[model samples]
Target: MSAFHVKVKWGKEMYPDIELDTGEPPMVFKAQLFALTGVQPHRQKIMLRGATIKDETWDGIKMKDGVTILMMGSKEEDVPVEPTEKTSFIEDMTEAERNTMLQLPVGIKNLGNTCYLNAVIQCLKTVPELHSAIKEYKPKQPESSSLLTLAVDSASLLTLAIQDCYKTMNSGKTAVPLILVNLFRTTFPKFAEQGEQGKFLQQDASECWTELMRLLMQEITAKDPEKTAQNFRTSLIDQFFSGEFSCEWKCVESEEEEVTKSTDNFQQLLCHISQDVKYLHTGLVARIQEQITKKSAILDRDAVYTKKSKISRLPAYLTVEMVRFFYKEKEAVNAKILKDVKFPIVLDIFELCTEELQKRLLPNREKYKDMEEREIEEERALKRGKPGDVIKKPKTRSMPFSFEDDLGSNNSGFYQLQAVLTHQGRSSSSGHYVSWIRLKGKEWLKCDDDEVTSVTEEEILKLSGGGDWHCAYILLYGPRILEVVEEGEETEVETKIGEET
Candidate 1:
């Protein structure tokens, strides 16, 4: 059968309307009960119709609507009790203790002017699929010695180094990406440039991000070969992080020339900042349609052309780079723009897509709106309930925005900001970069080299450029998930059905 609601009994408490999906293992259901009853999943002993439920399957037991499940377990406290009753401050705790209490991820240490690399790595780690692919990556030995084969080996070694770095960070210690940095510098010699003081020069984080993604795209393939063949995207980077743009170029000098159409793949979108551009959306719109000089067949010589482009495909993860730096001829440096450009927490790019894509996005957009409204109504009902009343949470199901055949494409043009990399100086070469990552709800983690701290949504919004303060340079946005729920008016069900013996 499909998913259905059931009642769970634990000691003197009764949780009604606990939805269980038969497709998933019983352990998942038990985990859900664990959330409500505070009992560990392994310790939860569930019984239905006098038959003990196994962790793997629900074989002989038949389930229906409103069935009763008896669960027996006790919540274990993991933290040790303090001897003294005095208040405890975070400053008094050790590094491990502080990280545990704040739920912050480990930071990366800088090896002299390596903040750009650290910031880019931290931002990219937000994509769990990338990490999974790296773990499973195994490069083949080169059969014959060639430049191409050596390049492949280098890329593979870099991927392995990144995997090791991630493993070290997961151990709750500061990760020093020395091997990864060496591999990166060897692959891209420009990053190895040194100043007069024999110190490595600082690099642009956006450029570093682009180069790293390019390497990953070359080395990391999809986990399932059959699925990859059917989808035509061989690499996980292409499947999850690449987008397609459709463009039309028309000659402005010769009206009789036919408009040329083309499509191109891009891993990131550039937002050009100008005096008229006060918001990110405006900058992106202005960047997409511009005038260029090209050779026209009708006019033999170089002629002005109007290039208009629109997004034909969107990926699960979208990267946007702010064009805040420009090369100065006199200073021989990339000067930074300190103009403030406002961005949104939730961005909707429906207007920036092709007509066909916009039509495909409507269904999921409407479903998302309906689910949000239902959640609001449920919250209002909970507030109206009597004091000390326990309300059953509404059941939610994962809804994919893309087509069934497309594994990692986004059908809905809605995105939520996941990570932001900001620069804190006037020049790209001299500025320091930091990564701000969203941990959950309103909580965020700020990683500045080896220092990691917790911040809020309010602080993240202030990162928009204005002056010498930290200005958002690169933004990583993930698809906004839509959890579809059943259509029914929630009523106040009694919390206690019957007292347990």
Candidate 2:
């Protein structure tokens, strides 16, 4: 008899490489599971080979090594309630004990309406690459740069200050980086200026995002250019957060056209408005949909030019800024658009791509469509099945072609939303900025200054701006990579069964 290793998953927990003897009876396996998961042997259902394992020899079922098994049973145990003779009230607890029980996360103090900066800090923490880069960062050629010079140079101070804060966050201690705050004030003097009672005036979240991204690009080091091209992979921000556009300008009078290419090297996608703003994807598609009239190119004659734009490159991460704030000359302030523009958890941009790019993305799109159909079929069968019946799962295959350098590129022009920066108020200069960050599955976190709390997917969907509540101002979308199970990795059991992790 030989022993085999397999993983057993119960809920979110997984136990990998659990050894089992093939010579042992099914009851013996249940006993082992009972010890590991605290599930009664009789109540536990060991599923393998498309049927529940019974009290038969392991050889009778022909279990294989390196296979996964699903063990389903209630982990909760009921405890009988008893009458309490004595109870402690809140007033009875010691001060130290109460402090331990009510521990709070370290938060940045708002230096007079600095919520914009605070919100930005909390959101950027979600980027793992940024965290790692800041941790490994070193101030190169310090002798070449003086503190006075660094203070004047926004890039230098911003880099040092950001790295300092990141280091503090990494230390697992809750502390604020006052140095960073001062550096930010120095960089943007307008923000440092007092508005009311020594408080700073509200700043735009989009501006904060832009400035931070610019500083990060200047401070963060990129990998060797030659190696990146050779491997078809680039740095995280450049690989995913950047986009390229090809532009053509034609003069109406001369009937002459000039073609030029421009790149959004700074990781920001501008949202173009249409007649009625309903969905985010629609507005984005409209941005590159057609040609628009521009200022006259000729000085002597009244001649106009038509400018056409098209996307040439798609990054791993997409940043879309809703053009909600426009300068009002009469009001002398940026006006806000309260229009409710619905967005999606999963956004497809195939309609916004160039013809050749769309052709390249079709293969992955088809694969995803087929997978969706298979999943639906499985779900339908599951709905019709009786209780305790094992429902089979559909297997997924990989796409044929994808970018070599970037694993998370939108092979099929599909994106999953990762973060949203929202504003709640009438004007950009007066609204309260908050950061909503995705926290695994349908759960999200709302970071409003020092306060952080869990939120639902429904709440996130409602952020599409209608009233005074927080409206989505900036949206960050990440590529949804297609999952391809290897041939031998997933095979139907001769008798038809399932695998779980």
Give lDDT per model, in order. 0.80, 0.66
What lDDT, from 0 to 1, does candidate 1 have?
0.80
Give the per-residue lDDT digits (tens) of candidate 2, residues 128-169: 556677667654443642221121244554566666555544
TM-score of 1: 0.75
- The best candidate in terms of lDDT: 1
Clashing pairs in 1: none
Which candidate wins on TM-score?
A: 1
Model 1 weakest 10-residue run by lDDT: 492-501
lDDT of 2 at 7: 73
Model 1: CA > 4 A from native = 1-91, 95-97, 100-103, 141-152, 223-232, 375-392, 486-501
Superposing all C-alpha atoms, what RMSD in Å does each candidate have to the true structure?
18.5, 21.6
Task: Write out the backbone clash pairs for model 2.
Answer: 232-405, 233-405, 240-316, 240-317
Model 1 residue 88 distance off true place after TM-score fit, in angstroms: 11
